[model samples]
Target chain A: MNPRTSMMQGNIAVAEGAIAAGCRFFAGYPITPSTEIAEHLARSLPLLGGRFMQMEDEIAAMGAVIGASLGGMKSMTATSGPGFSLKQENIGYASITETPVVIVNVMRGGPSTGIPTLPSQGDVMQARWGTHGDHPIIVLTPAGVREAFDMTVQAFNFSERFRVPVILLLDEIIGHVHEKVTLPDPEDLVVIDRKKPTVPPEEYLPFEIDETMVPAMANFGEGYRYHVTGLVHDQTGFPTMDEVKIEMMLNRLHGKLDKYADEIIQVEETGTEDAEIGIICYGSSARSARQAMRELRDEGIPVGMLRIKTMWPFPTDRIRAFADRVSHLVVPELNLGQIAHEVEHASCDRAEVVRVNRITGDPIHPEEIVQKIKECR
Target chain B: MDYQKYLRNENFPHIWCSGCGAGIALKAILRAIDDLGIEQDDVAMVSGIGCSSRTTGYVDFNTIHTTHGRPLTFATGLKMARPDMTVLVVTGDGDATAIGGNHLIHAARRNIDMTVILYNNNIYGMTGGQASPTTPLGDIGTTAPFGAVENTFDISGLVIAAGAAYVARCTAFHAKLLDDLIRKGIEKKGFSLIEVMAPCPTAYGKLNKKGSGAKMILDQKDAAVRIAKAEKMTAEELEEKIVIGVLVDRDIPEYIQSCDAAVAQAMNARNGSA
Candidate 1:
């Protein structure tokens, strides 16, 4: 069976999908679980006239992608929890400056390099709050290998299309899992390119606002030159301290993500049409939730699984939609109730939801998730 | 001629005082970038938040004004992604040594192929001149109103100890020499840390009786030692002065060179195995 309609591990498909989407620059520092991504990119990037650099450390590795993206390349860097922690500052800058880049966070046991070789989804909150400030962010989580590939491509597409940093949140299980990946000729893929300014170089403000909210980005040599700062700035991209300007810039930073919520937020629901219990989870937990939901439905418990594709600027509306119908919702994650908070916030006192939290550097068992769903039932 | 064209003219005069070392350092960086014949596009200048970090707007390039003292971090991603491009990291004494000091050592330890021009004014240029990591003991600044009690850090010595492949010291007194060192730092293959000894006459200089900018330059020039004499000088004789010029240059494994080699070997083995 081909990838057209066959099962594939999420990580393999992500690697394949990234290649399919024309990602040419891959720089990473090795960490467990995510190491395969570096290995795969190292092997594949060179074959497609691209480059991969195993940086001295994760910090430099992430920095390399930031520089490469500005160099007019679709650059990506992968790391697990500790490495992701190191990349947070740059990721924040990427958000503030609207730099188009992709970061694949194959989260593992963390807080301080907890477990390098095991699977854990403990970075759910760090993915959104690790970096400082109130800048806008976009995160995409893949439930499986197909999404690993499709999401990597989507992460790149979203980064370019929106001119923001897009994160592909994968867990160690999804990152290291081996499966057959479907790859097609690159020419056939819908490669999303950044919106370059058609305005003349002199007239082009690098971060000048237009109708899209995201400014028209210009290549380095193309001459529409302006400054980009991590500080809150106005339409010109210069650092501004004016209170009004700060508010406007902050609003724009948030608006670019929140205003276009319908276009940006993504999710998949199974058996939700008549389900009494809703299972909410993401990353590798989404996989467990799906399996558990399957087992529960077979037992005729009337349960559904909501797999969140977009993690940050989350599938809030979807959770709200589910709130109108489901009597109870359950969130099982490797961390202490991160997405559960989002679910609770989105549920808005409509549905009774609780968290199943774990931090043992192990995956949530499908049976455990199903049991949680049943308990809610 | 059009310094304004190469600069964000609107943010002119900068946040620097009448005689700030970071501003001069910024000029040297731009001159070096222009001297190398690197296109504005082919070069990127990154800075963390500080008076020196503010230099990102002073030079025209694909610039990123990054968070505090993490310019090296951002530059790392930029250079790794586009190895073909020249990446420069401009930071100040406190930013590189205090807050972002971890990155400074790691970058040096890795000997990554990027030029880090550290503007060492011996005082935090922003937040009203605080005591920096490099602030000599007993030197008074805004924060050290009762005199800096910490031992001064020798930047060149620190970089060498941190495993930087290219380590050099230059002062604002030696602008031409410092500029040349900055250029050489850029041309280097491994991690190059050119610690520029700059003056903050309005802040540290004024309080420490370091004299006006001209006098400060003259003082530095008087005390400056060449590498030959610097090596010859007895430890006791060099207590109060600095030995300027290229202090350290040795071959080390550059980040990309090692990575490229590993990638080649892995691919060859895979092919051979297949």
Candidate 2:
């Protein structure tokens, strides 16, 4: 029989996607536009033989997810802007310790609790640099309800494969929108389980990096006892102040993503084969850009759209290549020039980068993006 | 018993001061785990930032030394994920009650199965000396230069009120009793808190003129009253006394067990509907 189709809300779709991805543990404190995700998970996870817990606060939620991940479960937590801000410290810890967990941040207007119920992509840069220090992060932004489902599953896969925290950046628009989704079969989806240590318990070192720079993980009760901490550490996972070891560890952390950028970074392009103008967008703004590109193509203007699915590690090489082909790039985002700045830096003075920015608690309309594309032309 | 077998010998001599009670507390915990014959791989020792939080680093087990004031939260997650493993949280007074106070109460309320060994030195021993939530009202510290004007917290009473299945208080001076209680706490199937009123000679002692480390530990032994004896005494009569013993020990549904039951029930319901 064919797969079942149902009308699902974005938040619910994300929850279903997580269940499909084999996420057996979820801990989160509710926040607006993201609360539905938690509610749905709370109801659905148990039915699927999973655990969902409401923690005391956002910090505890993040901490719990990390602990669960270390205990050999695919874990996740959902939050909005304020809660995401509260989670930065533990997020940093997850980064340094190489814990495989997923964080779902449904974006809203915010420096502090700004427009909790409204749609805005204001957390684009915060998703990249909210946590302190030099660390690598994988952030995927989904443009629609279907993409939300697909990317949530991908988030878990990437986190498990790389042994790093993955952030699913969902704007309030995509999180709250309802759409018809055809759920995929679990057997058809590519699910990656964390690599367990092949060495004996006495020989296992938690932070021992193999050729891939990603260490195999052993769960707490799995006979491979080891230490995990936030401090800069050596292969034994003990805290060290040695400069050489610290440098080597830091490089390995960054190298895991840097060397694997080809597999990590993903972007979707349309009509860019022979185009003079290209529109750069992501999240909800990508929808507007796609609409505008279609209208421009119908009008016989060769304008293409490059929608970023993976926001961090920045997709610089692809943007630079696009810059070489297109004469001008018009970037539209909900925030005032966060990713636009990166686009300009990546273009390397090749393509003229013009930003169409918005901070109002509303989606960037296709007409506004069309006007920018025409201006770029 | 050879306690050295459980310790990460290369990581020590530890960062704790010469006369600090955290070492004594750590020794007692190791003894309890050893006495219980729990496997090293089946125990996960979690600690937050403080002098006491360093316990995870020195122990040869599955350990996690987490960020400040967050060990209980992490322990909750670990216990929930692997309910079969014995999870222990080692936190100091400031790490447990001051910054992580909210987590403490919530965890107790949920009655998650974990043993929390709160090393209460009555001051922030790691950061030199600063006033802590459990510090005496008239105690002196660097932060409380003259004297502390704030009231202290009865952490045992607090956790008992918050619905922990097992709550106990002991001191570094009472090593045997502390060890016994820790063993009991570990055996319990819900949240168990053993608040150890440990000494900080380098910090709280020097500032508050509480005598040398040996003398302070002696004072703690003298100041403590058995819970049964304290129950019969008047409030005014027990003013300067610390009540030491099991404050609450009873059976309750554990958090992870309850979650597992919920999962089973939901699955069963779904099956019935199908």
Candidate 3:
């Protein structure tokens, strides 16, 4: 067999990426812009001796992914806006129970199934705060088909390492766009598996932590015979209402991600050195921002672009430094200034922040971003 | 059977109130597992939110207490991924028939290889006497102060119609029968459902003027009749009685087997085309 560049859609790349990352289980419902992911996996996974199930709904999909993760398989699910909303509760369940899984939310216009075929980055904040409570989350946004493939593999790596659900946020345009790309060989990719317990079955505690605050997980039917619950629990994984135990549990759950922020956060920057204007964006908007910056730079304007790959664990410190150096920041998003507020808060009044937002089921055009950069400069 | 060996002794005295039938159901489940000689490591005990769901915590297995009405879905995933292991689900009436009704019907329809033990106490015991989908008509609860007007569900019958391979109904009062039914359900290769009619002395009993736990259990013993005997009775004669025993038991192609076969065929077809 000879290798050649194959034309592939972003969603197909994601499914291939998951399979390369050793994802053995996928359960999801059909939703617009994300349905191709399920379709591809449904055809591909079974051939690789992996399981693919189209669950009854998005909630069940999330639940099944969590269960499959507990069964010692890397598992994933995909859906769109309304389905993403339905999955929040189980997402929270996975967070509290510390189950490793991946969720792909192909962004579409919404508040309730607004536009199925159109592109919008409206779920950025919902991806962070959609699930109730103060649990830790990791979300990644990809700007192109290749990044969708690369970041999906990264999402699984992060989920396995941190034992948290990693969200791969893709907009409708990126998800549906066809691009020619060389798929990476599986042998060259870095894959991480969850750490298993070293102790004997009689001595194992499912929630017992070491210095890392992450307990080694034992798969079901592995003789550990441990209990896992959504309730706040102690090192033993049983339900606990004790104030001290609850506080300790919450602190560890939040602290593990916070401690590894340096390893978890990824940001791509261009021309930020000695620039007068910095355009900060992610997802599909980042494509426009990059184009706008290139055009403005050609006109002898000091415009820079910072594209965020890891959306949550927000990269506040990097943004703060960029804010301090630049005179103004331009944030272009599909929604009405959702992540712009995060940029403003991270800037801490050091730079003037300009919000360029659109919600008309359309992608932000490079011209609009260029206009914002020129006006802000 | 040495049922105590299956329990997490330090986690006791359990949170169940005096005269609660959850303890009885738990004991029966443990006894059934012990009788069947199933290894603890091979059993994945799953449950949803409720008083009955808390049984996962006390049992020494690979237990998972999930969100309300969602254990079967989770169990389905686990079983699909690890078909060699036995997955069992424990749910309450409200957890199974109210919020999780869709999952129940679909799980049965798929005939997935898992056993579901639905603890039907007729009221939301943990939430303090609210009416559930299994609450009988004219039964009083906190949400049904003027007496419940809604009809109750026939859980076993519904699963039987939904294509479960094994379906049975037994009460907490009939401990041996319940144990035997659970064992039979667990041994089945496809979806098996055993609806355990437990009593909630603090909730259902108090609200419905059923005296104490003992009195309610006595009521169950009096009202219960074998399916064979009940078949001979007319609708009017059987109106007040509860049918107990296996309602359905049949040989069927299990879901996991079908899924594996389908995958094999698809792979073969892809290879052929390639």
Candidate 4:
């Protein structure tokens, strides 16, 4: 048999990339845009000696991924809007407890199952704040199928590196798009496993702060035992109402994330140094803006593009640098005004952030972004 | 046995009142797990938010404490991802029957391979003793100060209709029987729900004149009847009676098996082509 790379869609590549990333356990129920992921994993996991479970619902699917992660397996579950809401509580638990699990929420138009097949980037805010409480989250948005594959690997790696749940926010447009992509051979890929505590089982504190700010994990059946709860917890994973412990735990949680925020944040610039107008977008919206940038550049409009790879952890510094370089920044998203709200704050009166909003179960067309760019003049 | 090894080090000694039936239920569940010799790593003890939900933190075995009424969904996920492991969902009547009612029905209807142990204290214990979905009518819970006008839930019958492969009911009063039922539920292949009728001695017990710890167990004495007798009894005769025994046990198609088959078929095809 000859080994060669083949063209594959973004969702399929994510399943294959998960295989490369050593994700052997997958639990998901089929939902639009996310169904291909469930299908691909369902077909591939068994061959790789992994497990695949099509749960009865998305709620269980999310829970299973977290449970499997605890069982010494890299696991992920994929879903869209409504299913994302269902997984919020456990996602929060995974966030605080620092459970290394990957969740792929393919954004679709929705307050409640609004457009199952259509594409919209309405979940940007939900990805950040859907889970109750004040826990720091890691969310990555993939603009294309290739990013879906690459970012999924990064999601697993970040989850392992930081010991937190990593969200890969993809939209229905890219999730369903058919594209030719190259998947690296398994031998060429490096997978990230959860950092097991090297400390003696007796000395292990599941949530104790270390040099990396990530607490070491004591896998089930291992001798070092611990308790973990959703309540404000101490270093030992026990519930603590003490104001000091509360402050310490919350601070550690936030500090672990924002302290190295520079390392976790990712973005791409098309042309901002010598341009006066800017287009800031993510997910599929960025795809259209990339096309619009070329058209605008041809038309003699000095507009540039800044595509966010990491949506949460905001990349405020990168935004600031862009804000300093540009006169006007345009934010285009499927929501009425979410990411624009963040950009406005990060700009902090330095730059005027204009929103190109799209609430319908459709993406912001390139012409619409072009219109926004024309207005920037 | 080092039972304490299974409980979370932080939430030790439990928060149950002296005579609370949840403590008895917790002990029975731990014992059942021990008697079965399930490995600590091989059991993912899932629980929904409630007094019983706290059991996950207390017990070891890859515990997952989810939001209110969502343990079965979580357990179903865990079981699907790790079919070789035992996934047990520990939840209360209010958590499982009220907010999580839909998930329970669907989990049973599909017969996902997971064990759900319901601690039916009849009243919602965690949220200040409100009238739960299973609260007995005419009882006085915090939400029902003028006496409950709502009819109580018969979980076993509903579970039977929802197609749970194994369904059983037991009270914390009958420790041995309750433990046996839990063991049986654990051993079942598909979705098995064992509703343990626990007591809220501090909250619900005092109001119903359940007296003390020992007297509460005594009150459960006459409420239980054997399955053979119950099969012949009429509805009126069964009323005011809490039958304790295995209610439904049958082999059914498990969700995990079906998933495995798809994976297997795909692998076989790939191997043939290769």
- At residue B58, candidate 1 shows an lDDT of 69
**True-vs-predicted CA distance for residue A14, candidate 3, Å:** 1.0
DockQ of model 4 vs. true complex: 0.43
Q: On residues B10-51, what C-alpha lDDT tens digit does candidate 3 reach at each position? A: 899898988778999999888888888899889999999999
Listed in order, the DockQ scores are: 0.46, 0.82, 0.84, 0.43
| Model 1, span A139-251: residue lDDT tens | 88877776677778888888998888988888888887756555554666678899888888667777766567887887654455566687878887887889997887777
Clash counts for the predictions, in order: 14, 0, 0, 2
The better-scoring model by TM-score among 1 and 3 is 3
- The CAPRI classification for model 3 reads as high
Clashing pairs in 2: none
Model 4, total clashes: 2
The TM-score obtained for chain B by all candidates, in the order given, is 0.94, 0.98, 0.97, 0.92
Docking quality tier of model 2: high
Residue lDDT tens for model 2, A1-377: 45558787888889988998999889999899899989988988777666789999999999999998888888999999999999999999999999999999999887698988888888888889999998889999998888888999999998998888999999998998888888887789988899888889889878886798999989889888889999999999999999999888988999999888999899999889988898889988898888898899999999887889999979999999999999888999888889989999999989999999888888889999888778765
**What is the C-alpha lDDT profile of model 4 across A138-254, one tens digit per residue?**
999988877788899999998888888999998888887877666666677667677788888668788887667888787654555455566778897777889998998888898
Chain B global fold similarity (TM-score) for predicted model 1 against the true chain B: 0.94
C-alpha lDDT values of all predictions:
0.79, 0.91, 0.91, 0.82
The TM-score measured for candidate 3 stands at 0.98
lDDT of 3 at B115: 94
